[model samples]
Target: MSVKRLDWPDWLLSTLWLVVIAFIWWMAVRLLHIPEYILPSPEQIVERVSSSPTYFGAATAATLRVIAVGFMAGVAIAIPAGFAFARIQLLEKSLYPFVVFLQTMPLIAVTPVLIIWFGYGLVPTAILVGFSVLFPVLVNTVAAVKNISPRLYFVTSSMGANALQTFRYVDWPMALPYFLSSFRISLALATTTAVVGEFIAANAGLGYLALRGVRNKDPVQVISVVLIAALIGVLLNAASVLVETKVLRKYRD
Candidate 1:
């Protein structure tokens, strides 16, 4: 029942790592006398971001909205479908290969067709994000649940547990670790793919901002956008860790 929070030592080490990386970046630029156009120092990036905070802020908000919608949609559809596949042998045999094939196709190639179908907006972009994240979660969850020993099923049934009770008592708890592992991988994919989706066609978002920066030949703006994108990815990863710790605390112990 104890609430889990990120501990101080972890924060200290993470901060120290960031400082070391900044120092290395600074030293490289200073020693090499690298031109700002080639690689701006960390200080320069900060200044650039500060100069146009409003633009970056709006773009970040747009991108985050896409990420959230895409991730939630992916989770809602993938988990139950994964369970159904694992529990039904015939369905798995027939459909799993099709799922694998869809997952293997490149998003770049798929994006144009999606735009044609869904039109150039958030619909196609969000669908791309969902598609990118769906497979890993489905694959891992089904694998974990299906691999549970048959003996466990016998024990659950002997205890008078029905199908739903068996899943509640045994199947879900055992498969949870694999489900969570897939989540970490898929969450990153969702956010990154969402950005790539935006690039395919969008009027707003960090992707759009980056493309504008490129066309205008402004490296500073591009670097600033890159930093913000990295920060968003880190934040999403931290959120995943928080959920994992809270949900799986007993299992961890």
Candidate 2:
């Protein structure tokens, strides 16, 4: 099999786009002369983030740990359960509505109850992130599996392929792209969930820092934390996209 090469032109275009955005942001900061209290320039925000490495590092680490653990757990549970739902009509009929309901439930409302039950710590935070991100992955995976080509199934079965064989050779490969797409969405949700979880209760994390900023009426710090969190989310999403590209390269054509 021939390996596909990266499109340098695409990379160049993306870089140009980023440069344009940065230029616009710089222009806005310079032209508007926004007060540091109201809207710190990106340069000031970066300086703050750089100067407070000790605090920001600890907070980032704590938040990332929660996000990683919760995201993994969510994916672990969602994938197999999704497959079961897709494969079994009765399971689908029984569980689909509940999944939908869970998806619709507000995390803000649930967070307090979770803290009450689980106490304030990493456990509750992990659970919150997991719960927040689980539905999209579960539903998307199920849909991906269910939508597998009937012809592929027939061809596999005609060759006397066992269920496992069919799944390994056909179903998995077909669903991988969709699964990755779901995960891309889940990663961002997981990060947001982690932040929310910390907001509910925590002495550490970017979220906690954000809350502290708010309490202290430090808008610059507040905006800084938010920008950092947003950056992390964007980075995580970009990482997912990279992984998805690598995994789904064969299907790109």
Candidate 3:
């Protein structure tokens, strides 16, 4: 006889896992009698967040604003740069080393320069976020363009296609999937970098809140910020996947 399968929804499985983890955390805190300063219980974190929902909500919005500006700016620059790299050998050879060098430079170091140039507030932080979002998307975009079969280009050329037509019909469609796949990675980076920027120099955002919690020795506040950041990453990733699926389906059809 065959065993029956559960075939549960993906969200249900994820929820169950989250519940299990929370239960384990609760048990550990209770059994070990851990001090809240050292490690706040999950319940305590929830209580902290609930106590000042507006404060946390404003922090979330600020972080998201940075992430949005940075992520968009990064992708907007990276795609065209990738295309140019693929199309122009001289340009790529001349600039690719600099791009790689810039990537190697620690954001912590570069951020001060950005701060000096752009001043504080959103600009420097967003640029840091953009840096985090930039490299992966750029590399993927280049790979996507380069990986296209030479025969495909030949076919377009043989059909008397102009540069614009060739790109419209061949380059873009082939590269789109790679670009979308990179988007998921970039979104996650965007969140982390935004928080890091806040950590370095900002009065607001979850990173600032977390830093304050650290100085104040408030484990609950720090953990609450962490949970919120994780939630944002998950939601952004899910949204990217949904959009990718629909866009690919439409393109394929």
Candidate that scores best on lDDT: 3
lDDT score at residue 46, model 2, on the 0-100 scale: 77
Candidate 3: residue 245 Cα off by (Å): 1.3
Where does model 3 exceed 4 Å of error?
A: none
What is the C-alpha lDDT profile of model 3 across 1-253, one tens digit per residue?
Answer: 9999899988899889999999999999999999888888998988889999999999999999999999999999999999999889999999989889888888988877877788777889999989888899999999999999999999999999999999999999999999999999999999998998898767789999999988988888889999999999999999999999999999999
Candidate 1 per-residue lDDT, tens place, 1-253, comes to 9999766787588779989999999999999999988888989989878887897899999898888888878878889889989989999999999999989989889888987788887777788888887899899889998899999999999889998899887988899988888888988898788777788767788888888888998887788888788888887888888888888997757
Give me the candidate number with maximum TM-score: 3
List residue ranges in candidate 1 displaced over 4 A. 1-8, 250-253
Best of the two (1, 3) by lDDT: 3
lDDT of each: 0.85, 0.86, 0.92
Backbone clashes, candidate 3: 0
Q: Quote the RMSD, in angstroms, for model 3.
A: 1.2
Q: Cα deviation of 56 in candidate 2 (Å)?
A: 0.6
Clashes of 1: 0
Ranking the candidates on lDDT from highest down gives 3, 2, 1
CA lDDT of 33 in candidate 3? 99
Model 2 lDDT per residue over 91-198, tens place: 999988998898898878888887888888788889988887789889888999989989999999999999999989998988888899999899999998899789
| Cα deviation of 129, candidate 2, in Å | 1.4
TM-score of 2: 0.88
Model 2 error, position 48 (Å): 1.1
